[model samples]
Target chain A: MSGFCRLERDRSLATRVDGGGGVMTGALAPIALSLRGVTKRFGAIRALDGVDLEVPRGAVFGLVGPNGAGKTTTFGIACGYVRPDGGTVDLFGEGPFDPSKHRGRVAVLPQDAQLGRDIPLLDQLVYFARLQGLGKQEARSQAGWALELAGVTSRARARSRTLSHGMLKRVAIAQAFIGEAELVLLDEPTSGLDPVQAERIREHIVAQRHDRTVVVSSHNLNEIEAVCDHVAMIDHGRAVLAGTVAAITGKNEEVRITLAEGPVPLDMVKTALAGDSVDWDEASRTLVIRFVSRPGRGAEDVIGQALRTLLGHHARISQVVKGRSLERTYLESS
Target chain B: MIGPTPFRDMLLVAWFELKEMLRTRRALVVIALYLLGGLVASRVFVGVIGRLEDVAADMLQTTRTATPGALTRQVLHSDAYREALVRLFPNRNVADFLLGLPPIVLFFAWSSLAFVPFLIMMTAADTVTQEVQDRGIRFVVIRTGRVEFVLGKYLGQALLMSFVVLLTGFVYLAVAWRGLQGFEFWPTLDGILIFWPRIVVYGFAFVGLAGLCAMNARSAAVARALSFVGLTVSWVLGEMAYRWSDGIFGAAWTAIGFLVPFSHKAALWRPGVAGVLPECAVLVALGLVYLSVGLVMFRRKDL
Candidate 1:
């Protein structure tokens, strides 16, 4: 927990220094949604215990957790579907559940909510749009645009009951994007989708980050890492770790270089980067190098120097990958 | 875009519910069967009354004492019959109207009002429970307030039941008009239409009760069963109260009977529109109370 706090602090500080391009700046962006000391109890089971989260404006935030870790519960609270027993939830600095304050401002794709089985896809979308206060013509137009965005425009006339699970999920995603929602909460958007459809949905989610604040909750760490700029890992109804994806996963400053030939000599690689922590995997022909930049140097400088030295020693590097994966970070943190 | 107001959002939910109800094949089939059953029952009722009236007329002629009209006059002038008419129609002489009409029309009016509420209960039993069980309500709940969702659902069920009641009334009126020789179309129509407001109120009351059951139950089957049980319990209690009205516990039982909707079903048969207003108001109040309680429970419940 202390380690996560340090990372969070560092990420905040880093965001203040580096504005918009490389990593998301939490300090500069306004908080789109904040949950403070939110607690929820279902009978004797505490679904969320003092959970705190801050999703920044225009940032794709991911809520990752194992099953029963309260990700969906948190989503429920944010969408005003579930009332927290204790604590406060603010959306755009107002209570999320207050309809007059937050009605059209927030949209949510609940994890397993099925569309009306007897309603046509287009009618359902149009109805959702109308609920958001769109005029009839505008609602129809927005519904069409949403369907096109979700890549399900061709099946607009199909009844929801006839669509496959993946298609229904896509349509549900489309429904969330209808109207001009400022904040969108998507829970397990790609859970039942195949890899291809999941990838497409991820692309759509990423596309939403430009104008809308997206909070995605899923168990797919890789997808979160791929699409989310900021993430919080929850375990036991508590936020175990949270920050920019890069900061959370790249804190150790480790890089892996896969060689084209047999495992490089560990001694030679160590001699080249004498103070760095290096490990060699003989079977995969991969070398992992961990280093912290000195006052006058940076990570690129260190990696550049190591590469020059390794090449001078006749090492053939095939691929170079930066940072540890989110899976590894999640496993370690939770 | 701005979001809808509470009223607009509730209307949207009601519109959606109406569409869903109309689209449901089973519900449509049930409504059709109810109309058909009303027509068949109307025919059977007219035939039975015709036979009974003939038998009475034959006995009167053989005894050489009186005619059927004189007997009807005697019955209409009786204390129990006049009391019942005054209770239903405080302002008008409904006994005179009933005396002028054939017995079948009077019998059909009472029987239909008594039976339509059950049909409404059956039709609306699963309205909310199906959505709750399917988790379809989650989408609308997020968009609109839970209170709006409940109100919209109740309104939709009420509208559906009203439509079914009117359709059945039309069918019954048509069957009687064609089957009976001297059926005064306007008078019989006026007699049936007098009960329309009360019938609507009664239908809505049953819808509200069923909606209350539906909101609380987890499954459609359970909701149906619970709503049926609720209706049965109300009827049984009301009947018991009426039966015990002469006993020592009569006051208490009557007070308890009024708590259920069944006690007030006869209010629709009153003489004038103004005479039945209080009953309509009572039924509306009961429906609203049931709906309000359901809304509170639904809002607190974990979806």
Candidate 2:
């Protein structure tokens, strides 16, 4: 089996661990959403095949993939837009077939979903709020607050067709945040936005992460890395990597040492740390050391030894940084 | 907090659909067109009635000296009249009584019954297809049940068509009252009040069919085309069946004829409270069937 399949199988065993009571060390939160052996087909193409995923409550999970990776299909299944041909999907412990059971608790920001052209922005927002079970007066009030939160209060009365693409996206974001939904599924939330606007949306998502779970599916790996604490990377209809950003990226295995002066010698570092791989960039005066420790030895032990050796050699070290970047990890995994 | 009940959700969807219709200005345009059509039809009917009255007077002077009631019976029971009634209202003698009504009433009843379906098709053709094409249905479907969404759209279209039919009925009544000053107020008002509700029910049958078409079609243009084509095909087949009702294919043609709305046009002029009940039941059944099929298809369709 592929690595993702093995990970998925292991997750089922982990679910049986039951609140850190067995060999597992930490308490695992109850799953907010789960998919088991889900499969879908369109004509000859298999969109999703035997896919399994689990999202814990109170997590900012990122679903990352390249084009045609079934990210949008998975989102559609969760929101009850696309029906699966086999297996099952559960949201908040309810089957995907019945979203109304979790109404007002789940909201979706579908990528490129256009608002009704003739509907005023405020009216459209209010209508969505009312669909979440708010009364007319409360729906109107909350719509106003949602618009303000999305920073589109100035265009509240504008018809959706009259707004630009960026403005429409903001309106859709406001519509998703209405009723303070417990689980927000945002598919490509910042797919088409300027860097500044994308940053603002990222900050908004991070701010909202303290209370409710947010599942964001995006091709923007950098944005995913910046916002996500937990992530699952799907490729060609199967999840290739699924874990905390730190664990999946293997950020703990490497350390970066920045020297005060230029020309840190690679040979000196290589002789000092025998088994570790070291790369010295003479122009930047930085040494990147990759540690491959044995089981239970840990990267910290190796790093400590290297620190003492560098100090003994009288090397001027300015700063130490840890962990691999997510981009590199994503490229290696996919 | 509790979410909306299925019934409440359906109502909310209907309310939103109605608001969308108004916001898009389609509702106002449809209503104005229906009323204007009714006025123009009533005027043409008045001119036709005047010429027919003069012809009837000349025929009375030339005929044998018979009682007025006998003359009326002769005119209605003639072979030509019977054949015309059979062509319009198959397996029924109700048109005999319909023929005795005022010329203006007959014209209004026939014209409204004949044209209301097209009016409904025009108004409701984009009801579901527009949202699906624009991907706006994603927002509402997540919040409410699919069954409720279909029901709401169907109900909203039915309600709009009902309003249009009712307004046209009043316009016809006003035109008839002013043009035919000798006509009695209570009877003409009663005839209109009785006729328009049945027209509204018939209008709903078309609305339901249009909703089904819209749900399956890929775009607003396709929905309109499908509705138009479906109605035209059904109408042409119904005409053929009626025309060929006396041959070896008589039984099959007659059976197929009843499936078309045009086959029930005579029911619009049926007198008394219970006269249109059977036809109303059939129209309601058609509406239910269309709506049920639409809901089934929409529930399984990908959005």
Candidate 3:
């Protein structure tokens, strides 16, 4: 808690650098993956434009963006599928992206990349494990454990071509969890899954936060918000905003209260809550209160003051949202 | 955490590729065509030898016609066939030894030497590109080093080509058992043995070169076309070098021809292990050089 408080103070003073996505953080956990000034082009189309990202270790970092955003392309460069035309990438501060150097330490589930077509899924996982330097028997055991984590152990002997779309997606995810990788990057891990399965996958992702760094990109904003501790939102190859979930959503800076139809005593509530700025949205009859938070100033304290003032004014409050939802944040920025 | 376990990685990747190719339709078709070509070659060579036997029987006028083996052996054991073998071999003793074997075995050996290179090219052209096009290589290249991945592919295709060439020996045994008059077991087996390893070395040179094409191109069809163009360019360069051997351009043209696989085939035809062994080493060296160049380019290719 103390370390996070100091990190917040340092991040506030850090300026945005050349890359538009530069949300700075000071000496957090050892960064799991770092990209600096990365640029990429596919013919005349620019896929990525000087994008920079820092993924701290032991966090479920979400790469949130809309359709045709640079999230997948950024993953491509990190995974060495597409060589960046410019800039550098570092994994665990070790070195550049060489497959041998990064072998068992980094695992990636590329978007839409199929597994071995007719090979049994377990054997394919074993092949990947063996290449990562596991012995035959150990590779088999680890591969089985990965399949169980993905809940696909029943189809371990099935060929990839014979599986349904959701089954194959699970198999692909299973491969990423094969070895004892320190960092795992999954692109749309729960894309084709039903609601129940998607929730299970989200739990699996969050479970990795204890020992491994996980990075995921997806269109499902609710899942991202539910599972991710930190996030960086990009639009059209530029980082629009990035920070912890609390920081980006202004969870401490703002709270919204929906009041029932009554005499709207907005000025009385504003005067009662002295320095905070309050506004009313007529459509929803919700008060959006923003405050400048400082040390020892808890969000609970600000929310309590606002609630008391509104109750004293005899406003019947129906609902209260703690912060701006991630959906609204994405819509506003995108 | 990577270690100095490149050999282990290569073996694993190679085995995976070998299994993949075993189930590939392109490899199966190429193998079937090579076997069919062996059958056609056996038919054609056996007919030619049969006609020679008839001519010899007429000239000697030994109407004993009861012994087809005797007539065929006597005819091939003549000075005329010895001269023909001499023209094919660089050494006189090598020619004399080859003249003792059956004509169909010799012809089968020659056809495999001529046909196995194309088989390798066709099978290897899609080995890298199809994976790249489908992004399936993302799974592999991330697991193994780029050098090991490319080398694994070459080693996989090389071993499969060697296996396919060995299958030709069985093709010879099958055809000789059914089609020939006197198919001596030991001699026919000996000829097949000599031919298999030699042609495999020839096929090895082209497999690495075709892998070069596959790694450089993005589509399987383009890779196949490039491999054909690579083979054609090598052959045409060698032929042109020889055609102008009497001019001042001969030295440079011959040097250019030396860089390609086509110029190295003549040494493969030399008749014994001592004569052929050095060329086998050279062909392997040439294959490695082609592979080294391809690996440099493949490492730089995006995806």
For this target, which candidate reaches the highest lDDT against the unseen true structure? 3
Could you give candidate 2's per-residue lDDT for residues A226-314 as a string of tens digits? 99989998888888889898777666677878888634556766887887888876776778888765777676776776678777677
Alpha-carbon runs more than 4 Å astray in model 3: A1-29, A262-268, A294-297, A304-315, B1-4, B47-70, B87-90
Ranking by DockQ: 2, 3, 1
Best by TM-score: 3
Q: By DockQ thresholds, what CAPRI class is model 3?
A: acceptable
Model-by-model DockQ, in order:
0.37, 0.45, 0.44
Query: Which pairs clash inside model 2?
Result: A251-A323
lDDT of 1 by residue, A1-334 (tens): 1000000111112221111112222342388999998999999999999999999899999999999999999988988778899999988775667654455567889888888888888898888877776668877887877677666777788888887887788778777877666789999988888877787778777876767799999888899999999999998899989899877877447778888974366687788788888998778788888888557665676678768877877888898777788999888876
Q: Put down candidate 2 lDDT per residue, B1-303, tens digits, no spaces.
A: 223477887888888888788777766787788889998988776655555555686876664322122333355558897778768875455666666565555666678888988887887887888888878899998787788888888788787777777777777777767765355567667666667788888877777777766678878899999989878876887798889988899999988777766666656566665877888888787777877887788888888
Q: Which clashing pairs does model 3 show?
A: none
lDDT of 3 by residue, A179-208 (tens): 666688999988878887787778778877
**Candidate 3: deviation at residue A280, Å?**
2.0
lDDT tens digits, residue span B1-303, model 3: 333577777778788888878876667888888878877777666666666767777897856443235567765778887788689776887677677666666777777767777888888887888888877788877777878877888789888888887887777777766666766878888878877888888888888788766678868899989998888887788788767766888788877777777777777656779988887887888888888888888888888
Please give the ranking of all candidate structures by TM-score, highest first, separated by commas. 3, 1, 2
Better of 1 and 3 by DockQ: 3
Scanning candidate 3 chain A in windows of ten residues, the lowest lDDT window is A1-10
Docking class of 1: acceptable
TM-score of 2: 0.82
